[model samples]
Target: MSAVIRLLLRRLGISVIVLIGVSMLIFAIARVIPGDPARIALGPNAKAEQIASLRAQMHLDESLPVQYGHFLADLSRGDLGISLYTNRPVTKDIAQFLPATLELVFCAGIIMIMLGLPLGILAARYRGRWPDHLIRVLSLVTVSAPGFVWAVILMLLFAFYLPLFPIAGRLNDSFDIARVTGFLTIDTLLAGDFAAFTDALHHLVLPAIALSLSGIGQAARLTRANMVETYNKPYIEMAQAYGFFPSRIARIYAFKPSLIPSLTIIGLDFAAMLGNAFLVEAVFAWPGLSRYGVAVILRKDLNAIMGTVLIIAITFLIVNIIVDLLIAFLNPRIRHSARGSA
Candidate 1:
């Protein structure tokens, strides 16, 4: 087999192993936590027989190994079991909630790329100028503050004071656009509801920006550092000596090379938004999987918790795989070296 194919296969294998490990760890942790899922579901007022019956129905009475076996078997068949709190299939609950989180994360990722990359390139092009210093300071400030803090600050400034954007939620209650794909923006567009789409976009702005601030800072910093290093490279110097404009050199010669190194970390930052967005979601009262995740954990709903964790893990793995493939494609050295070895 070609080295690239072998490398991809290896990465796939590692992703599977990592997912399995995450599942096992989460399962073990959920079980070890000091609370009976059945009892929690039943509540303090429920009788012993009720709790016992629920336990029996849930197969919580089984031995840990047997329970784990059943869990794996059910997972193999795309069953995530029933949620104790929601009293619905875990997968169903995830389906209902996950899209909101995905929408928010996707928006934030766009903001990160749009704002971060250009700033980085600009900063690198300017080097030690005032604009570069200003970008560096702003990035530092954003990176130092937690996301929730930004959420609050942004909400106060834009939502409360100026009132430019809606303070909370995915959409205003008046808009009854049909849910085609569960993504409000796309669904609204598909429905030809430009008004609803505009409202949805307006509502998404603050929260997406809040959730993306840290990622933007990190992306900018990483991109700037890498591009600065690239500016010193022989090829960049050659391009400059050949009478190419500094702007052209920075945009073409320096930017693309620097981007390859920055892409992996940028991918990771985007994946991390799934977790870090919880506080932002809570602040905005955005109905997403992060809110559902918090509810299940608080209620000690084992199946829901496990399902949420597993989905997040799967997403992280998928992002990493995409990043790896992109890196392999962008960096010819990897492919050439692999071919040489083969």
Candidate 2:
């Protein structure tokens, strides 16, 4: 096999193992938490016989080992079981909710890359100057505060006071666009409703910015640090000695190498947004999986919780794998070494 193929296979195997471990851990943790899921599902007014029957039907009466075996068997068949909270298939609920979260995270990722990278490059290019000092201070301020704080602050300024954007929700109540992709922006565009698309984009701005602020700060700081170190490298010095323009040297010789390191942690930050976005989503009242996750957890809905966790884990792993492949592509040393071995 080619080196890239072998590397991908290795990552795939590792991802599978990590996912299995996470599944087992989440399953055990969910079960260990106090309260009977069946009782919670049925509510306080439910009769004893009803609770008992529901418990038996859910296999809650089975031994933990047997229950785990059943879970594995169901998983093999791509069954996530029925959600007690939603009274629908876990897969069905996930299908409904996951896309909203994905869309939010996607917009946040764009904000991170677009805002963070330029700030980093600028800061690095102007190290020890007033601009660098200003950027550093600004990044410090952003990194110190959490996402929810940013969400609330941004909402207050832009949504409540200025009222430039919608204060809450993914779309206005007026537009009734068809849900072709479950992503408001895409679906609106697909339907050729330019007006709805504009509204959706406006709604997305505050939440995506709130979700991305911390990531942007971290990415800028890391990129700045890495690029500063790169500046002292022999090639950079040679580029400077050869009388290349400072901008050219910074852009061509320094940025790419510095970016490789920054990309790994930035990728992690992007993936973590999937989880950290819950608070932002709650604040904005976005109808995403984070809201569903909160509902399931409060009720101790086992199947729903497990399915949500597994899907998030899968997303995290996929992001990591993509980062790894990108790193390998960017760094000639890894690529050449892999090719030699192949």
Candidate 3:
């Protein structure tokens, strides 16, 4: 077995364990909550008989063990049960809104990587200089602020005052592209609508930037610290002694090693955006899973909440697994050791 194969198997085992643990925890939390899903679904005015019927329908009247067994059975068949609030299949509700959240998260990640890595490199290359101090201060300030704060500030300045980007939503109402993918950028391009594509990018820009701000700061700070430490390593000193070009050494040698640590932090931030998207999406009126989560939670919609939490947990696990793989690839020790017979 190759090292890559071994690493992949190990990651798969970890992922399964995580999934089981998360499912159990979320299932327990959803069940133990005080509110009755049946009542919430039927509404405040529902009659006693109506509530009893709904409880039976939802299996809330079943023994706890039986209910859990039913849930697991449904899960095995890819059903997440019905939403108490919407009276729709939980899977269908997630299908409707999940793509938007994924799109937002994806755009935010791109913005973070594009801005963070380069800024970190620049800061490290000019350590102790005015530029380094400036980036450090800027990163600290931005990293300390939550994504919602940045979203509101951007809305007020760029949306209300300056009127640069549209205040909210995914795309302009005038564009006539089909919503096959639910991603306006892709849908517009597929329809050969360059005009609509440009409009979509314009809409995506502000929110993406807002989501990326803290991630960028985190990446830069992590990169700067790692690169600065790498800069003092004996290998770096030897490279300098060998008359290697400063720029070349920094870009090639130091950059790769520093990036390994940065990758971990970046992946964590990217995963966190799924949860953080709530306020940002709400403020922008972007219909995404996070908004759905908030609404479902407030309504005490058990099935909906379970579906949302499970999806988010799965996404987080996937992200961490990818990060682990990347780290293993970049770190020679792990890659080499993974293949050894045990």
> Which regions of candidate 3 deviate over 4 angstroms?
338-342
Model 2 steric clash total: 0
| Stretches of model 1 off by over 4 angstroms after superposition | 1-4, 338-342
Which tens-of-lDDT digit does each residue in 1-342 have in candidate 2? 266677889999999999989989998999999999999999899999999999998899998889888899999999999999999999999999998899999999999999888898889999999989999999999999989899999999999999999999998899999988899999999999999999999999999999999999998899899999999999998998899999887776899999898899999999999998999999999999999999999999999999999999999999999999998888887777745544
Sort by lDDT, best first: 2, 1, 3
Model 3, residue 290: distance off in Å is 1.6
Highest-lDDT candidate = 2
What is candidate 3's lDDT per residue for 1-342, written digit by digit as tens? 277687788888888888878877877887788988778778789999999988887788888778878888999999998887777999999988998888898999988888888889889989999989999999998899989899999999999999999999988898777878877788889999999999888888788788889999999999999999999999999999999988888887788888887898889999998878887898888888877899999888888888898898889989988998888888887778845655
Let me know the TM-score candidate 1 reaches against the reference structure. Answer: 0.96
Model 2, residue pairs in steric clash? none
Report RMSD for candidate 2: 1.5
Which 10 consecutive positions of candidate 3 have the poorest summed lDDT?
Answer: 333-342
lDDT of 1 by residue, 170-200 (tens): 9889989887788999989999989999999
